[model samples]
Target: MRYLIMAEGEGDGELLLGRCAAVEGLFTDPPPPPREVLVLRGCAPGVRAEWLGAASVVGRTESGFEVWWTLVDAEVLSVAPHTGNPALVDVTIGAGVLPDDWHRHADGPFVRFELTTGRGAVRAVTRSATDGLVADRAAAEPLPLRLVGCEPAEPMRAALRKRRGRHPGYTELWSLDDTGRVMDRRAIGFDAEWTRPSVLGGALVDVLLSVDADGLPGLAARPAWRLWRAGPPQRAGSWRELDAAGRHAWLMLAMRRERPAGPDRSGGEYHLAGAGLRDEPGLHCAIGEALLGPGGYYGWGWDALFDSLCGGFGLVPPFTLVWHDFAATERELAGEHDPAAGPGYPEELARELEERGVTVLRA
Candidate 1:
């Protein structure tokens, strides 16, 4: 994979310098550092200078395989893969200069990089003129120029305002082959550890199915629980009035039914006791707090629910969950309440549970 960067203006070079330096730290394992740094000048007409270097470090990071380099004050920086042999040049490009799209809107100031792992391949090409970057892969793809983790550089952030909210709010774990092609990709959420191939593919599928036609996943609403007096408030016609244990039991049953019958089926039973009703009131509030934890996935909205059901919170399927006070639980869910309690909470829960074939039973 060849990465090219081109920068013009006063601070642009300095920015590239910092970014490249950071990348150099990516490869810091057994591989030894580059013994020689090469500098090339006047590579092309109107092109000022270029720098090339090599690092032998190779290892795994929380994200994926780490491989990168630094190019300060250079029009180009070229990188080669760490094959025991040093002759192979895997990446070659000018610092801050990205590749030109098939359509050439301009000829200057771009950033381009390619990453290939065992899971899949990602190629990004962004021209400063356009003000955004586009990264692509087979399974998980983001809206053009949408930054996932930290915010992007200044002008780019301003240009991406319209598309900024489109980020999936999760990181996609990827692995690359020796040749720099991405082989696998997995979508991971907060406080979650990366599992094997199954988790990767499963998470991606869950996201795709839950998202709207525009590919944006459902956004979370308000928190389902609010403190009132010493205990939680019970809205006149809401699921909050239901017995906590009973509601939890129903949710467990619903979860079980929602899954397909197969090897993955849990086939076990879970029980929720109603003893905590004084402290936790509504079904949504109790379940969100108990299962997802305080301020976790509670009342965030559909995406959070889907993510929770998909095991983002560490709960997997195939088991039956039972609760006492089934009738009281049912009444609360079917009751009327303000949207603040999450409008359509019951309907959405029922719809998803019914789809999965999860069954609820009262003891």
Candidate 2:
């Protein structure tokens, strides 16, 4: 039998019927196809639809209307009502914390409650009833995947340079040893047309790769422009609207989302659609790993040999960069090196990171 909840106050009768029981209740006939109605004295607008399906909701209206509703499982006032089955709850709370009066039974870490028990009983009833429907639907496509600790090498540098022009105020140069280790690690040392080096570490000879920016933000912003010229434009974010922090946030979220598979053989192992990195022919680079911290997140691109180093090191690597500024620390450069910069704790830091499954490539 259906449970009809008639409000003792104004508006709640219509409001409850409008919200919980119907999808198009606002304008439907016969009060929007009644399922089970629970009338109350007062009303609460915040009480959601899911809550209605499970158990009673405590709510009040602006005019001092208050009410709660629950399906009836037992006999009530000579009325045909759906029996409101009592709920049972068993929860684990932290030790040493004072037990709240809301729980009926609290022994050690576990607390148990029956639906007809008291106040919490109704909430528990509603929660259990709606759990399946609410939990089944997945959340929105996650924030995009982000590339962290991205360093530009020869191919990326040449690719952007060929796509754009000689960028001033930017430096892009780096080297990888025969074993894929970054060698004589230093930020790129050069003068492009549109940028200038605010800081300098001089240039290295055996440059395996280089890029204009020391961090991923700069790399991400410029790629869109280059990609457009390379062929039909792809869907990379824009440069003009986003700054370093904004770019980093956007890229990090973007990289984590699932996208179509990459056409290239090298990046095809992970189901591209199921993978975080967006798969597009125009993708100029791949993020190998990422780090997160209070300052924020940063991304990095790795070379072809990067996969090997990660694999050899027994790492499931997060994003592409060999190194990164995951916490957004304001250092001289993104991943700048200083042999004599004083060993505050570089060796220890490196060891800790490696132990945590990171392949810390030395500069």
| TM-score computed on alpha carbons, candidate 2 | 0.18
Per-candidate count of clashing residue pairs (backbone under 3 Å): 53, 64
Which window of ten consecutive residues has the lowest lDDT sum in model 1? 17-26
RMSD score of candidate 2 (Å): 27.6
| TM-score per candidate, chains pooled | 0.24, 0.18
Residue-level lDDT tens digits of model 1 in 113-149 = 3321111111111111111222121222222111122
Q: lDDT per model, in order?
A: 0.30, 0.26
Q: What are the per-residue Cα lDDT tens digits for candidate 2 across 23-71?
A: 1111111111123322221111222223222233322333444333223
Worst 10 residues of 2 by lDDT: 15-24
- The numbered model that scores best in TM-score is 1
Pick the lDDT winner. Answer: 1
Count of backbone collisions in candidate 2: 64
What ranges in model 1 sit over 4 Å off?
1-268, 273-281, 290-303, 337-351
